[model samples]
Target: MPVLDLTDLPAACPPGTAWLGLDLGEKTIGVAASDTSRMIASPLTLIRKTKFTDDAQALFRLMDERKVSALIVGLPLNMDGSEGPRAQSCRAFARNLDRIRPVNVAFQDERLSTSAVERFLIEDLDLNRKRRAGVIDRTAAAWILQGALDRLRP
Candidate 1:
């Protein structure tokens, strides 16, 4: 499998298969997954970053258990819509992930994803700062995945 555009992701997956969403941060990897119907995304878990091999193994274990068939990774683009070092890092991670599992991976623009999620946690959920910090990464991953799912709408 290869890194694909968001629009091309569906073709890479078999019907009824789920898609895993990843928000790769410096210290932790946020994980989310779409329903089998691909209708909704939910925050799953966060993987504390370690070695690449360990991280990959952790991610793969989750994917396998969830029956995920593809990936939608958050691409941290600059506000100017330009790819920066973070975007490059995401691409490299995607490439490495593909090499390990041969899974189709797509990048979704993730500008303001974390901020949006933080706002939701504060305003809507009314979570305390400490609580928010605990789950922000996974929530942001869900937001990123939701954006991709919205684009897939007919």
Candidate 2:
């Protein structure tokens, strides 16, 4: 397995194995997981930034523990759909992870994902700024994963 195109992910993964989603930020990596049936995605955890080896190890542990067979990483595309430094960083991270784990890794356009999650937290959940900051990335990862799952659904 390798870093895969989004169009190829559904076919690459085995049935009943969940998908993991990642939001790779400068300070932290937000994580989410899909259901075994791939119908829903939920916020999982936040990994504080350290060395890349440490981060990949933590991610690998989670994948093994949760039976994740594929990954859908959020690509921070610009509003105009251009790749930025953040997107390149994300791709690099995915490439490194692929080398270590050999799992199907795909990217989803994550423009406005954080803002959308913030809006939901404020308007629907009524979370304050501090609370939103604590969980926003992971929640955004869920939002990104859910979008991909929706597209993957038959």
Candidate 3:
């Protein structure tokens, strides 16, 4: 399936399945998942970047295990809400991900998502640098997913 507009995800969502969230970084892909009710999101895992085929297969396996049918991928937009190179890369990932198998994907504006996650970690969790580095990506993925879920809620 081609990537759908972000707003189209809820309507296109299939029953009895959950949504997966992705925060794509240069070296890793952060992952999160929504509840079947689509109300809450939790950080799931991280996928270290490797071959595209390897990454896709790992992601697909997680989706299969978790009954996930759609992806809400973070779109790193400029502060002015413009698509930049990073955003374009995410769009490409979505397109390429679809080629392996059918997957509905949508972009959620991810301005400051990583920084916001960092702030929360520092202020609330107070985790040390190494610990923060270990969990930041997946935690950011949860933040991204929660933002989408909040907006998508009726």
Candidate 4:
């Protein structure tokens, strides 16, 4: 499937399949997966950047293993609500993934997602710097996925 608008995602999914969320950073791609009921999102893994093919292969492997039915990729929009290079890069990545897999892909505005997750890890969870760094990306992926899931709730 092609990339979809946020408004179109809920209707696009097949029943009983989960959604996967991605936070595509320069150095790593954070991943999160939803439950079969599409209610909860949990941090799954972080894939270190290599080649695009490698990244896509790893993601597809996860999708196959997890029975994911859709994808939600973070769009790092500027504070002014404009697309930047990073957002374009994410779009490009989504496009590439779509070419390889027949899965619904959508973008979620990810303003301050990382900061929010980091603050939660530091202030709420009392994680140290190293621990925070190790898990921040996957946690951010969960944050992005949760935001989408909240919107999907009726």
TM-score leader: 1
Model 3 residue 57 lDDT score? 99
Which regions of candidate 2 fall more than 4 Å away from where they truly are?
Answer: none
| Per-prediction TM-score to the true structure, in the order listed | 0.98, 0.97, 0.97, 0.97
Native-to-model Cα distance after best TM-score fit, residue 150 in candidate 4, in Å: 0.2
Off by over 4 Å in 3: none
lDDT (Cα, tens digit) per residue for candidate 4, span 1-154: 8789987987887789999999999999999999999899999999999999999999999999988888999999999999999999999898887787677899999999999999999999999998999999999999999999988888
Q: Model 2 compared with the native: what TM-score? A: 0.97
- Which residue runs does candidate 1 get wrong by more than 4 Å? none
The lowest-lDDT stretch of 10 consecutive residues in candidate 1 is 95-104
Task: Evaluate model 1: give its TM-score.
Answer: 0.98
Candidate 2 clashes between residue pairs 3 or more apart in a chain or in different chains: none
Task: Work out candidate 1's RMSD over C-alphas.
Answer: 0.7
Q: What is the lDDT of candidate 1?
A: 0.92
lDDT per residue (tens digit) for residues 1-154 in model 3 = 8788767887888876899999999999999999998889899999999999999999999999998979999999999988999999999999888887889998888899999999999999999899999889998999898998898777
RMSD to native, candidate 4: 0.8
Alpha carbon deviation, residue 1, candidate 1 (Å): 1.2
Q: How many Å off is the CA of 59 in candidate 1?
A: 0.6
lDDT of 2 by residue, 66-131 (tens): 999998999999999999899999999988887877878998999999989999999999999999
